[model samples]
Target chain A: MRLSLLSDLNEERAARRAAVLVTEVGSGEQRLVREGQVGSDPLAKDLEDSLRQGKSRLAEQDGLQFFLTVQTPPVRVVVIGAVHISQALAPMAKGIDLDVTIIDPRTAFATPERFPDVPVLAEWPDTALPDVGIDPYTAVVALTHDPKIDDPALMAALRSKCFYIGALGSRKTHERRVQRLMASGFTEADLARIHAPIGLDIGAVSPAEIALSILAEIIASLRNERRRSA
Target chain B: MRSTDTDILKAAEAWRREGRGVAIATVVETWGSAPRPVGSHLVIDEDTNFLGSVSGGCVEGAVITEALDVIADGKPRMIEFGVADETAWQVGLSCGGRIKIYVERVD
Candidate 1:
């Protein structure tokens, strides 16, 4: 058993309370699993359940016992429009450990200089998102006011099981966007999944305040909040 | 070691050095619908105070009570779950499977 994996079982020393440990099974390719107090990785939970039923093999992963404690790791964030909001949003998002990625076909906006720690993609949404795999744990936010850059991503999020989707625009712009989406094939249910005119009714003015509101909404969504629509 | 793991271990080891009783609870085995994997744990002090979780909140009270008793006796135990135990899920372990917990007290 790898010594790192034994850390899970060892931490429970006699009277010490147990903590959950989640380790990625593979090193080369990323296969992240959240099995502890805060890891809601659906597949990880499934695998843990399967093993708990008389299959003790999971107890010996790579010759190590593998669960750990209650810390919720970072969530993945995909920003489709690399606009001013993202310039402000990425840093704040990183503060909470959400691995932020800004995608834009415009080379000028999508540069490492603009986004130091974050990964920038000078590619369009259709190509970028598939590589990212907008999983259930992924939160997608669209900040571009332009339809050509934002539309494809909104469509992709609608089709996937992403945890959160937010788009920036004025009410009128959103209304028009809705019409266009309806014409293109989105149902009321699909449209309902978006938080266009995004962010809570926080009355945010500056880009930073707006970013905070957006993050708040994402947190609320992660907690599965339901709000009555106007 | 990962910072999170190190932080938790430091807490555990400190308690042990203080001459306070400690027991490590490990999810040694799990099946069907267990919420935690085979290595999940819930550390418990002699007072039944805890630092981690194995089955959400389910089985915790029992584990705590057992933990206190283990502290008193200095005996280690392996508590099994799932096959037949409503008490474990009373607070909420409806994973519908079993878990084997190796609860060991550090001397």
Candidate 2:
């Protein structure tokens, strides 16, 4: 099949287990173009021709042209701490279609019973990192405050190249952790990647609101990076 | 559309035989009130395309743009969209619910 880069977006969305929306784009003169009819599709171009115009979003189908723009792709959330915030975080993450993976070394917290119908990894950071595969395609969040758990995971995340690596802690905790990481040989640049405190400063008072804060930060990172790249 | 890897390979093999280019798109995530669950897929041919729902037909316009770039540069790109976007309504999904879409082009 002709999976041009445009279509390749669809392909990768599938790889990442993401949902997609293909909208029909046209001017005011053309709006009745139905949804799944190929005849209504604009002259479909392979990725090469598609790249010829990043801003050209005119799809004509059944002789009627539609207009559309490519929105953001789906995101995957890998939470290293499975605490109360996590309980609220999972569904919140799922609300926006993030492929959420909750990891905790504590068996008490990481059981399927606690997080039913979700992907829970009860392994230590080191062991889980490889299995989880921290690719540029994935976002890593270290929620456990335990250095043994969060640090190893952060090290693994830094070693690999995950898009976002957020850690949960207070400003004091962040300072101490920085000292530890600095002594461990991590450079300042590496430390900069960590979104310490792990969320936006919204004065969240509950686990659920904290989850929202974290989700908001992730959203900000994704969009900000997109604008920069664009 | 509903083709498997073997199906894609078979189709790609045919295109390769004909000396044409082939591309692959994989779905990484799906959000609330979505028709297709995450992991659902669709493959596009050089001319004809395959099927399977990704978004509810809202953000594919942008995905196609990047997928083509991946095929041209022979590199991989991670693309995303949905509620998180300020202008997400431009594609009809700017509602509070969001989904992270990653597009990787495999030749």
Candidate 3:
């Protein structure tokens, strides 16, 4: 690997962009393919598949063996509340290599003492999320249970390509929330993308367990062959 | 702190920039119950200092030794280890899995 290539790869990773390193195993030849430039590559089909799956693998092209190192942007979880669930979820998510950020307008709840070692933004989601930069690789969890706080975040998530959008609430609460979002002009299909009554039905009775369930659901959404959609 | 692939790559770049010879060993293929997944990296400096793993703790010694040679030769080579190989008994993957690693020097 050339230093220039390695530096470019690190730059892509730092910028949260996807890139692939293609190495011709036999000849020691290599090339870097950025995410947007994969379409014109000779191995476009295989590159697309590998990038989508975010897995590196060996490929044979024209009797030449090549190794494709797929480098996907890190998966990020943006928790809309810094409550007990976010406290639990943040650490657990970090343990699994998921980048977590907590956003809450409530200063007391968003204090660093409550959530250590995680990025806590004591700002409103509408103001904070843009700087956080929600992308296809991000998962948004509305855990505030406050319409003022959670609603704006959900709207931001819905408008973006985030992989998972989960809201902490009951079915009835979600129904009311849906009505509010509908009145705000979100289609039924668009609202369907939000996983309400959030988390898997794991019979979670405590904040930590609920956080585990939400993390599990986020992983399921992330690892699905196709991106979860309405 | 845990050394993720990002950290490993960043270390490799930093090490090379600091005028040290560095080689990166990557798991290119695996069969059976491989300890580490494909694309796992182990970056080795000239002095045998290494971070990350291609086969958990198994086969790292051999990979690092080969990585040193790659740094000397400026050539990339693919090495394989498995339960079936006699070297596996010496290096001991013990996990009953096969893995192919590619070691390349950063020029």
Write model 3 residue lDDT over B1-107, tens digit each, in one string: 44678779999999999999999999999999999989999999999998999987989999999999999999899999999999998999999999999999999
Considering lDDT, which of the candidate structures 1 and 3 is the better prediction for this target?
3
Say which candidate scores most in DockQ.
3
Strongest candidate by TM-score: 3
A1-230 in candidate 1: lDDT tens per residue? 12233344454422233233443222211122333432454335535443232122232354544433332324578998777888898989877656788999999889899888889999999999998778766789998788999999999999998889998999899999889999999998999889979998899999888989999899888755322210
* Model 3 spans > 4 angstroms off: A226-230
Order candidates by lDDT, high to low: 3, 1, 2
Give the TM-score (vs. native) of candidate 2. 0.55
Clashing pairs in 3: none
| DockQ for every prediction shown | 0.08, 0.03, 0.70
The DockQ assigned to candidate 3 is 0.70
Docking class of 1: incorrect
In candidate 2 chain A, what residue range of length 10 has the lowest lDDT sum? A26-35
